[model samples]
Target: MTKKIFASIVTICGISVMAVMLLITALLNGKTADSAAGHVRNESRLIASAVEKGGSDYLYHTDFDKDMRVTWIDSGGKVRFDSHKDADSLENHADREEVAAALKTGEGSSSRYSETIMKKTVNYAVRLSDGSVIRVSGVHSSFTAQLLKLINPILLILAAAALFSALAASMVSRNIVKPINDIDLEHPDAQKSYKELAPLLEKLRTQNSKVSRQMDEIQSRREQFSLMTESMTEGLIIADPKLMVLACNTAALKLLGAGDFHKGQSIYSLNNSDIFRRCLLNALGGRRSECILRTGGGQREVIASPANSIDMVCGLVVFIMDVTEKQELETMRREFTSNVSHELKTPLTTIYGTADMLASGMVQSDDVAQFGENIRGEAERLINLINDIISLSKLDEDSAPRENENVELFALAEEILDRLKLSAEEKNITVSLTGENVSMPGSRTILSEVLYNLCDNAIKYNVSGGRLDVKIAHAPQRAIITVADTGIGIPKQHIGRIFERFYRVDKSRSRKIKGTGLGLSIVKHGIMYHNGTVRVDSEADKGTVFTIELPIEKKNNEQGEII
Candidate 1:
């Protein structure tokens, strides 16, 4: 701004100076031209007097004028004599313009000018008593020649004038602009300005006060808006009708996989998804639109709603809500219900069939015992499945706190192994116990259930003459229980779902295994109830290992209650 002011001042000053110079030059040139023409008129009148008295003899006797040309024309319109050239060689002067004008007007003067180079030639003529005409002419370079001759000096003068003008303009501009630049913006009222600016400064002071108040209010609102946006979990974005981003929260930025962006940039710079584009277009068209967007961050439901004012769409307010966890919970609930129904109905159906046969006396005496055994087996399976289901429900609900007790983990494992030794014998597998008698504080029932399930699975899946190993060890602050068996291990793809209720690794061998598929799931929930962690290691046709870890003491049992 300062440079612009200074340059404008210098330009105006330069133009003014050049105009004055040109005007003075023009006046001087006009005066000089008039003065020269007057001198030539006087000289011509004296020459005419001499030619009139001396007749034809005067032209031959008089000395030639060196600076000008004079010619004597005969009355027959031919040049009879000339001072500057041979008389016979010259063209007829009676036909000349000056001569023709003189013959008609008695005396005549004419001047011809060339503006291109600023040159002029003046001619004066008189009619003598004879039929011939007396003419006098002067030739000199135009004013432009004089100007060109003085061009170097004139340019020097102009350069000096421009320099002086520029310096003056610079100083003047400083005087004009200093007060404004020196104003203390933080305390605008303290400005010391000129009298002419008093009204402006007073108005400025009033306006400054209003502006300050407006800024404070805007800042306060901005802070409140920022707090509201940051406090929310759902993502929010505001956009103009052109789909240019006006504002967005941090959640929206993260959801769209975007970094810091400025306002008024097209939203396509953030996401070029066709569905998102359609939603934006629809919303801007005054129609609310929604889309499910999936990205690396998970699924989000994007809703675009138009903001309306005065019966017209003004902008769009988009809300992006994360629904990944909610969707997964819904799906799990559905699967759990279906699996529970199927698992319970299978056992109940078997028991009902057997009991119905027995009550009708359809079975012979010899087969009655087998039928009763079959009913009893199905009944036990049903009861065990029901118990497992109840325990799982309690864990999920985080119900009443269970009594915590200190139990020797190695002794508990040994007892469980002793009970499972017969099953191990039937499978022709060797059972062994290794590691220290690590004691941990937990619910005895849940911990024992966890250990028994692992050991039972190990024995059940063991190959003929395979080995079962139960290890209880102590870590820095944890009790580690590992039950490993050399058996047909789980497939890698099914390892992730092995702890899901009723999930079986091999459906064809499931019936031969002779146990509910809910065993591993029960192990998971029981161990989870005691504030412990469990991990599995397995290989196909090799073996499976279930490693359970319990804290030596309850470490911020955030799980709330143990069922």
Candidate 2:
């Protein structure tokens, strides 16, 4: 900016100076030409008067310089005297305009002409006492020749002065522009110090400082907001008026499979699930909405709210929550309620029938005692089923792990195998343990319960003469425990719900075997409480394998103890 202004100022000053110099030079040159012409005319008049006073002999014999040519014309328009040539041979000057004007007005004058010997002629007319007109004619070169001689030095001096003034003006302008160019708009302390620019620079510094501070404050606020968004468990996304992704949180990226969500990427492209797309469109139209979206891997319940007045400029902020587990729990709860009612009804019916038979004396004396025992056993089974249900409900409510304690995984597995060995022996099934000793951080009671349940289930479901494999191994970062059984293998459809509370592959068969469906659910909850995962793989009539993985060392809590 400074350079541009300097160039403009310098250019204007240079042009003005040059113009004034040229104008003055032209005027002076004109005046000089006029003065020189006047001098020549005076010289011509003096010579003509001298010649007229002294007669024809004085004019004809006059000894002026050779550079000056003199001639005289009579009233008859004939040349009377000539210095350069004979009077009889000279052309008549009476017809010349200058000579005629001088003759009639008795005044001398000059005019330009083209002739053989002269470009211009100056004439002086004097009437002598003898009543004969004496006109003296002198020829000279063009006026341009004399003007050049007079003005050349003046023109050269003016040209030199103009050049010097231009050079000086450029230097001064550069000095004035340099500091201004170096002034930093980003830093208020760095600015021009010249007195002329002080006020403007000060104002600029104040405005720049204010803007910089405002930008810094906004940046700080943005960082805090980003931190809050990242820390949230729910996935968040913000879109533009066109339903394009503008901002997203860490949870959103994870939920969306770490997909790119840069500017101009349509919200629908992030997840093509129909429900998600509808939510995005509805939010963009300023409507708060919600939808459950199931993707390839998981399901998300999204709650979209139109942004407040500040964020209405774009679209809206959509909150996403992973509700797959919650939905499964709700389904399990409904199924559990229905199953418990059915299960209790069957045992209660048996007890009621047996007691009525005894009360009615329908059974023999010997069978009555047996019937009473059968009713007691059925009542006990009902009590156990109710207790298991209560325990499962508690585990579900307290999903968080308790304080961690080191537990011997191999010992726990061995104990569970011992407890179920008798049942396995009755069915002619063998229970075998494999792998090395392993230790993990978890509640001993929970670990023992998980192993007991898994082993019992394995034995109960195993076919006669089948084998059960209980393996405990140490992995890179976790302890793996697997229970595999050659049992009446679960169907593919039933495998997914096997760990759900009160779910059974064959309700009648499970009841005949005195199998409590809560076993697998208990195992699942125990493993989950230990911050572990349980997965099952099975094939119909082939076998079923249940694998549990638990971290070796639990994460430390804020109090610096394992949690």
What overall lDDT goes with each candidate model?
Answer: 0.81, 0.75
lDDT score, candidate 2: 0.75
Instruction: Tell me the lDDT of model 1 at 457.
Output: 88
- Report, for all candidates in order, the number of backbone clashes: 0, 0
Model 1: per-residue Cα lDDT over 1-563, one tens digit each:
66788899878877887777777777778887787778667777788889888777887888966767777776667887777889899777676777788888877777878787577877787788876777777765676776777678778878998899789878988888898888766565443866776677777778889999999999999999989998888988998878888888888878887776777888877677898889899998889999988878888889999999988999999999998887776787788888888878888999899888989988999998898898888889888888878877777676736767889998998888988888988989999999997877877777777788888888888899999998989999988888999999988898888988788888888867777677777787777777777888899999998888778887655542221
Q: Candidate 2's residue-wise lDDT over 269-302, tens digit each? A: 6677777778777776778889987766587888
User: In model 1, which runs have C-alpha deviations exceeding 4 angstroms?
Assistant: 1-191, 194-203, 206-210, 213-217, 220-233, 258-262, 277-290, 308-310, 359-361, 400-402, 418-422, 558-563
lDDT of 1: 0.81
Candidate 2: stretches off by over 4 Å: 1-196, 227-233, 240-245, 257-260, 264-274, 277-287, 310-315, 352-374, 397-455, 462-498, 506-508, 527-563
Winning model by TM-score: 1
- Residue 288 error for model 2, in Å? 3.9
Locate the minimum summed-lDDT window of 10 residues in model 1: 554-563
